[model samples]
Target: MPVPEPALSVRGVSHAFGRVQALDNVSLSVAPGSFTALLGVNGAGKTTLFSLITRLYDNVSGEIRVFGHDVRRRPGPALAALGVVFQSRALDRDLTVRQNLAYHAALHGLTRAQTWARTEGLVDRVGLTEQIDTPVSALSGGQARRAEIARALLHAPHLLLLDEATVGLDVRSRREVLGTVRELVAEENVGVLWATHLFDEIAPEDDAVVLHRGRVLATGTARDIARGGDLASAFLDMTGLEPAEGRL
Candidate 1:
């Protein structure tokens, strides 16, 4: 049998703004049922790479593929098979949870019937069944985040790109969001590229990519990268940053 194509593939992709290079020959892949952590600081080119994948910024070099479809050549299908949750909250505060999802479904060209079915299922999946009729403004931060995630999955995208999905939530909420996505990987066979600066968000079994100064510094399982030490120390070591007081 032929080998399956990666769910998400970034090949030799690079981007720049004027004289500042934002990404340098960056490449990575995420397979179905896999969770890959994109480890990087604020200016580490994570957003630049995501913009290229989502076609927000055109790639000046290299190629991006979503589940065998080239993002540039087959943008329609490529985008259709991909879901994204940006760092910023995207929910409409005035709209009810169900209404927000319905609008997104319409944008995706889902029929009224399809929209209802998906909305019901996704709301339940994201643990928002009871809050489906609640206005986004009435929900807590974590609840709003869950609703946004449900909207992103409305199209049943095979690959999910979450940029700092758990930013403002408390510990319990953060764990809940992370666990929900991890469950999707196993139960729905979705691939995830979770971009975040939070080391604790990464689990030991996860595959990880370290981006520093607009380039990839390391790639391995989260545990391998940590090497029995904590992720903080490992990250500092890999990026050649001095450990404070000889410790992380």
Candidate 2:
């Protein structure tokens, strides 16, 4: 049998902003039913790569593929199989959770019946059934994040890309969000490429890519990268950041 395609693939990809090169021949892959952490600091080109993958910014060089479809050449099929939750909170604070999801589903060409069915189905999965009719502003931070995840899943995309998804949440909320995504990989066979600047967000068993200065420095399980020390120190070793600059 032929080998299964990677869930997400970026090969020889590069990007720049005027004079500053943001990404330099960066490449990585995420397998189905697995979680791969994109570990980098604030200016490490994580968001730049995300923008290219989502087609918010086209790639000037290299290629990006989702499953078997090239993002640029086959945008519809590529994007159809992908889900994204950006770092920014995208839910409308003025709209109820149910309304927000329904609107999004509709925009994706889901019929009225399909929209309602997915909304009801996802609310319970994301633990937002009771708050489904409440405005986003009324929900707690964790609840709001869960709502965003639900919105992303409304289309049933095979690969989920989350950019700093747990960034401003408390400990418990971060754990909850991580748990929710992990469950998707385990039960639904979804692939995840989660980008974050925090080391604690990465689990021991997770495959990890250490990116710095727009280049990949390492790729392995988080535990292997840590080498029994810790992810942070391992990053410090790779990026050559002074101890004082070591926020990751």
Task: Report the C-alpha displacement of residue 200, candidate 2, in angstroms.
Answer: 1.7
Model 1 lDDT tens row, 18-108: 9999999999999887999999887889988988999998987999999999999989999999999988888889999999999998888
The numbered model that scores best in lDDT is: 2
Total residue pair clashes for candidate 1: 0
Off by over 4 Å in 2: none
Candidate 1 runs further than 4 Å off: 242-248
The worst-scoring run of ten residues by lDDT in candidate 1 lies at 239-248
Instruction: Give the lDDT of residue 202 in candidate 1.
Output: 89
Give all candidate RMSDs, comma-separated: 2.1, 1.2
TM-score of 2: 0.96
How many angstroms is residue 13 displaced in model 2 relative to the true structure, after the best TM-score fit? 0.5
Worst lDDT window (10 residues) for model 2?
Answer: 239-248
